[model samples]
Target: MSDNVLNQLRNKRNRPTVEPRQDALVPKVQPEPQTEEQNSPQETSPVPATDNPTATPADTIAELQAELEKYPETRRHSAIVLEKDLDQELTRFCKDRGITVEVFLEAAWTFANADNALLEKITTEAKRRYDQRKRVGQIKRLITMLSNSAK
Candidate 1:
């Protein structure tokens, strides 16, 4: 029995252990959705960063809505999950200005998508946030492992 137990322990120690694949550690990247320009045949210059600096939010929203109507049903509906507090604040802000949250988000996307500088800023911020989240997750996993071992 002692020899059998020793053999079992030795076999377990000598067995090849599989480390996680490098690609598994990395996040899976989804292909970027094609933009309007990509879908169109003719190449056009990007929209000017700002057509009118003094344009009010309402004017911008109205213009965006009109522009959207030009295309024949190209828009697709998507849902986003926001924190409760942020959602409440956004709802109240839009309500105070007499604009729907959907319009506000659409206008923001249009403005951000048009400008190169804004796009760069967004990319940088997104990367920073992603890295921060990854680090937090790693730390949490380490703490969990340590606690389990202690138990």
Candidate 2:
């Protein structure tokens, strides 16, 4: 893009500039207490096409939220607090990177939900490290004893 176009784009919005915030706007993990019914996936039937622009606040909160909860019985819905500047930056970043936040979130959810045997892996690693330390201590003692005898 030409400098003139870039300048125009930048000046197109006369909104007051917000100070850069330090904290990245990310989705906060809010684990809700799960009930039995909430463990099932809600079967959201396909909604037919409509000529409504989803970009605006014209859609009711309840209506938009309803679109989020598909299998409410299987999983819980999380409410997010979005900081406006952070949200805009994140959106631009995603667009620039050609990344789908939903896909990444889904993959993350799948990994988190899977039985990854994390505890077992941690335990095995701890034991291995402990054994290595013990061996190193023994080797140090052996070297000290041999060196003293040689001296």
Candidate 3:
């Protein structure tokens, strides 16, 4: 082998591999500042509170009644039944807690709406018991069959 050829081979083997530059791999992010005018209440027209401080309970009830009239009478009757039961439950719970029915109802609504795990657990337990009963029935049938075969 020629000296030049051997040197060339050695140089090729020893030379470090060049990789492609990756400056573009990292993105440049610039956060723009929010303007004072954009943050101002005037820029976003202050939403006039539709909450009427002066509206009496009677007025609120009348408005609700009007809204309820839009639905069928059967729906209203069902809603009344649900409301009465809710009220009764609230009253009972409130008496136990030494609090007012209204306060207890508000708390109970919050609690019931927050998590449905209790409901799910109850249903699951009921289903498990039903399945167990079915299994017991199958075993009883098997025993009955064995006894008949022996006779």
Candidate 4:
């Protein structure tokens, strides 16, 4: 086996075990019950009144437009880091169709969100990949243990 393959196996064997979240396992604290005195109504400050009592529909639209201006239209980019071969395959896939990887991902997202069957198919594919990876990990662990014992 190559040095790289041996290094990878060693890294997996020495990987740290993740502990379960203590906060998640702990029970949530319950709020104390309010007594009659605590629940009793008390004098409170008056709430602020709307700035415009008789705002027109056009004014409301203008206000919404102004609010939207605060959050200017911007394109957000996300990335997925794939292994070397997978990365090359995805790049080739997009290149064959004369589209960028980002465009391909966006189109796939839109199609999956719109079509239930496509979404289900993608989910199944993901599950299958996860199961395959899990099995591979188990085999790697077994190989690591066997190698260590032989040493």
Candidate 5:
């Protein structure tokens, strides 16, 4: 090849090319300065007392009555005093024994109303001593019998 033609080809290969400017590729976003209110601490409004409401006493009583209606007539008429822990325990105990609180109360009333025939038969202290003596005699008899049988 000619020297001029070779030099021209070499120059074309070695020379740096300028690329077109890309103004459309960049996104334009301006930083906005924070206002005084935005920079300050936010003030939250207090929750209104009326926002979270509860059922009234009348409404609650009605709801309880509705639940009671789902029960049997006997159970509906049952008087349950849920004031004390003992009452609650008694209710649970009655439920465990497959007896209603009403039936248990009725039995208790009947027992209380019954004549004190047993009480009249023995004095309180005499009854205690009699029971103690009876237990002690039985133990003594059991020990004597065991000793004799061993011999």
Candidate 6:
């Protein structure tokens, strides 16, 4: 083979490959620069880095809510379990309703976030007398709302 052809083949073999992207398109909008006097927390959002452990849960949640407002939707971490038949069934159940388990759960979490007392009540089992299945169904509806809200 010619040296030029061999060089071309070698370069092709050494080319770096990009991983298959599953992320939805994110807009290229940039945040405006803050002025010297605009450093107040109320005036400008203080987005903490992911590695900043000092960032409270409320801070993180607020950031997520802001992101949701801007793009209306964003990709998130997900998994596929090959061995868990029940998990597969749950995924299918959500998919059949035009949603994913992540979306369904996110909606439920958002609804729960609206009421701080709800978490305490659930943990304390204050409403233990309530029908378990009924509560589960209610959570499902919340998930649907959350999924729809993102869309």
Residue range 66-87, candidate 4, lDDT tens digits: 8799984858766675668988
Model 6, residue pairs in steric clash: none
TM-score attained by model 2: 0.24
Give the per-residue lDDT digits (tens) of candidate 6, residues 1-151.
6999999989989978899963222222346688999877764335433544445566667766887898665675667433368688888999899997877878977887788898677656635634665787799999999999999
Better of 3 and 4 by lDDT: 4
Question: How well does each candidate superpose onto the true structure, as a TM-score?
Answer: 0.37, 0.24, 0.25, 0.41, 0.25, 0.28
Ranking by TM-score: 4, 1, 6, 3, 5, 2
Every candidate's lDDT: 0.77, 0.63, 0.64, 0.76, 0.67, 0.69
- 10-119 per-residue lDDT for model 1 (tens digits): 99899788986643222333466788778767555454444654566666678778988998674567786555798999999999999988889888889989998998
Which candidate leads in lDDT? 1
lDDT of 2 at 128: 90
lDDT winner between candidates 3 and 6? 6
Q: Which stretches of candidate 4 lie over 4 Å from their true place?
A: 1-87, 96-103
Worst 10 residues of 5 by lDDT: 45-54
lDDT of 2 by residue, 8-101 (tens): 9888877788998632222223457789879987565354333343323344445557777764444545754344786787678778878855
lDDT of 3 by residue, 1-151 (tens): 6999999998989978799873332322335577976775544324332245355556657766887999756322222222457668867877987997545545665775667986577568769968887898899999999999999
Candidate 6, residue 70: CA error in Å? Answer: 3.2
Between candidates 1 and 4, the one scoring higher on lDDT is 1
Candidate achieving higher lDDT, 4 or 5: 4
Please rank every candidate by lDDT, starting with the best.
1, 4, 6, 5, 3, 2
Write down the lDDT that model 6 would get.
0.69
